[model samples]
Target: MTITTTRPEPASADLGTDPQEPAGRRVLTGDRPTGPLHLGHYFGTLRNRVRLQRQGAELFVVVADYQVITDRDIADRLAEHSENLVIDYLATGLDPESATIFAHSAVPALNQLLLPFLSLVSVAELGRNPTVKDEIAHSRQSSVSGLMFTYPVHQAADILFCKADLVPVGQDQLPHLEVARTVARRFNERYGAGIFPRPRALLSEAPLLPGTDGGKMSKSRGNAIALAADEDETARLVRGARTDAERRISYDPAGRPGVAGLLQLAALCQDRTPGQLAEEIGNGGAAALKRTVTEAVNEHLRPIRARRAELAADRAHIRQVLRTGAERANAVADATLAEVRAAMGAVGSA
Candidate 1:
């Protein structure tokens, strides 16, 4: 049997002030604390999260520790990785006072919300999720974990537990958010109560920078420039980045993905377009282009790296920030879970 899937409409137009949500909107966005964040993350969603927080939106940035174990065999590194993730969030200008940041595993209520949400979605439907399919393919594993297979259901609980009206995600992730919307709709329909909001995807305006190999920027790919990378390491990575044999510096992504990748990185750093930079560099050659891109990246990252170093030294303060964040998050999540249980007529819902 053929199972067809329809993609959600890109919510680009809905980003500007939603008249429906006059009291402002609550937003939920997160990163799996599998590794240190990189420039790809900064441009992809981190910057947008900060902007939304400053605009008075109730923002929740979850350090998704539970999601990290989907593929990782070494669970011991989660502690260090989770800490580093929060440090990167702070260093990247995410104000703890403005945004509620917490680890996913810290919220037991969120996990409890998962069972009902899972019942709302079918196994065949879950198998059809584009994001899950892509992730499984990317994992290069022969067998899939049950936790990984049901990730979209868990993600639904994550958003609904906060009653998030907005979910900041890339275009590629819109389908996953759509699954959450479907689950929310199904639950409300079955329970005859509007407890969960259908979270809309807030499409990011930032340009996605490709990896050094011109593929998706990923930590496993080893092409990403970590936000915690020191100046020397950053410089070394950029200098050793792959580029075409063609000496002329032009922005033809299809023909020269390697050079185009560098140009895209430079464009993002300088807040300019790749074509504009390519034209300006006109025949400056690949060597000159690499040098310019490398400097721009290092200069941009210098302050963030310094801040991360300082935060790393004061582990006590980092722990405090996370501890307080967890408390704040639990307060909200617990209340939501209570309402969900009451709606479903679960025992001890009172």
Candidate 2:
């Protein structure tokens, strides 16, 4: 039951800027409405969004409804899912007043940027993009859609449409963000107008939280405990979480990912290091570890779940939030599109 003190450095080493420095920076980041957000979404990006909003960053949190159809043939309950995501954002402390939480489909001008941006990137480049490849493979489709093929370009449109200066991303998303950077550079060079900012990645410092089953947290796989899960549901999920047969608990990820993931989960909630927590729980066995994790997770998420219930009870308020955000997003996107048209000499009128 020994605890190891070693851990990998945070991903923020990619960019030296402090995440707390908000001044005049515009950030654009979001999630597709394909599934309910879980602990992974919280630690990965949602938490950052809230911090940025409070820090005074001009934030745009998109409910990427359009992207959901890239893999699924039919976006079942698309509207419901989108609203639910907005609720999660609200529950997690993102102010709709400070942050624009709009649906991607609602912003036509943003989607229009896709066509002009497509011209800037080569088909070969899209073919070689590892992120797109991984998404397509996981899509489990017999044939890929034309839209899915140009996924990165569409993302470029999303970023540049609002002239975002910063985009928070993980290592896996760096490739997608690179496409946006490339498009910005090429657009400015070809059109001779620096209309777009090369959005830089505000790489996350948080470790990737694994699912209860020790796999990637995925709502489809039922491994994730959604932000909306009640206290009983949270405890039940944690109790069923995978763990090794060792009688003692230790923070050895390589040797035992499941046990390590559980420890990490508890640590994130308790604001203590995994190694320290592991040492405290020395010789406590897997059941003791699971009990600790369940208490920590449920306690941490208690307020968020309560807020989600309050928000979900008011559907009208949720729709109004989306409407207002869409209005603001449309204005910004329209201005950007107009400038892009004027630069390209396509300036007659729609």
Candidate 3:
């Protein structure tokens, strides 16, 4: 896919930065609380979030519970999943003091912003979103829900509600962020410029890790290594991972996906490239590759697992963190909504 280099129109000076935001730039990124976050999530975005937070980017991580329900048949698991998600976040090194982490449902004002933004985009446009189409195919659902189809609109709300200047996303998600940018531009054109800063994609450079079966890492596939997985579970999963015969340890994703996938996993854990790891472990064979990957993965996750265990034991503290984050997120969301309402001349209660 071609990437766009055009910048959004300059935001209005009056719609300046939010006070609560840090001195530098701001970012908004999150995960759908469907299940425990996996290694895919860590390499994909979580690690970047941690670094950006340390760099003083005003970061907000959302537990996108609202988005999870679109294709899920069992909504009851959402509450538990959402809580576990926060544990993964903290355990993965996201400092609550540095970044605000909140549930999407907690910020009611964000939902209120979605309605007006929907008017800016058409049904055909949403259908045309590459990310949306890909997600639909991945879901393998015969029928699509309205909520699922219009997820881009909800995502726009998530970004704009906080007036996030940057969104950390992978290449596949550029279209989704573009949808948010389009909505922002349309809103500015209709009402006023600069109300929304037109969030840009802070593209992740990390290589995408495939699952044990050589497909995308997903919980449904039962091939992912969850960040919270214990040492034995992690080892078992890696040992059973699919690899090829006559494997002289190579990094050819297209030709030898299974072995290359294990190499990628090892590379990510070791902070090196797959090709480098492949060269280092030449002629080691698939068994050797699996052992290396399993050891590296378990070693890396040891601290995260320990921290998650400690945090998981404190359910009340987790709830309090969400509650506190929600309060702060609501302030920013409410302020943005007020501006949106006033721009459209919508009446507010006295």
Cα lDDT of candidate 2 equals 0.86
What TM-score does candidate 2 reach?
A: 0.94
**Candidate lDDT (C-alpha), each:** 0.82, 0.86, 0.84
Summarize candidate 1's per-residue lDDT along 1-350 as a digit string, tens digits: 22225555455533436445413778898888877789899888877776666666788888888987665544558889989988988998889886888988888998888888888888998898888998888764467888889988888888988898888888888778888888878889889999887887777877668987788898888999988888788778888888877777889988998889999999988888899889888788877887888888988878888898999999988888888889998999889888888998999695
After TM-score superposition, the amount by which residue 85's alpha carbon in candidate 1 deviates from its true location, in angstroms, is 0.6
Minimum summed lDDT over a 10-residue window in model 1 is located at 14-23
TM-score (all chains, Cα) for each model: 0.93, 0.94, 0.91
> 97-197 in candidate 2: lDDT tens per residue?
87888999999999999999888887888887888999999884678998789888889888999998888888888888888888888889899998998
Best by lDDT: 2
What clash pairs does model 3 have? 11-194, 12-194
lDDT of 1 at 273: 88
Which residue segments of model 1 deviate by more than 4 Å?
1-9, 13-23, 140-142
Q: Candidate 1 clashing pairs? A: none
Error of 3 at 178 (Å): 1.4
Give candidate 1's error at residue 303 in angstroms.
1.8
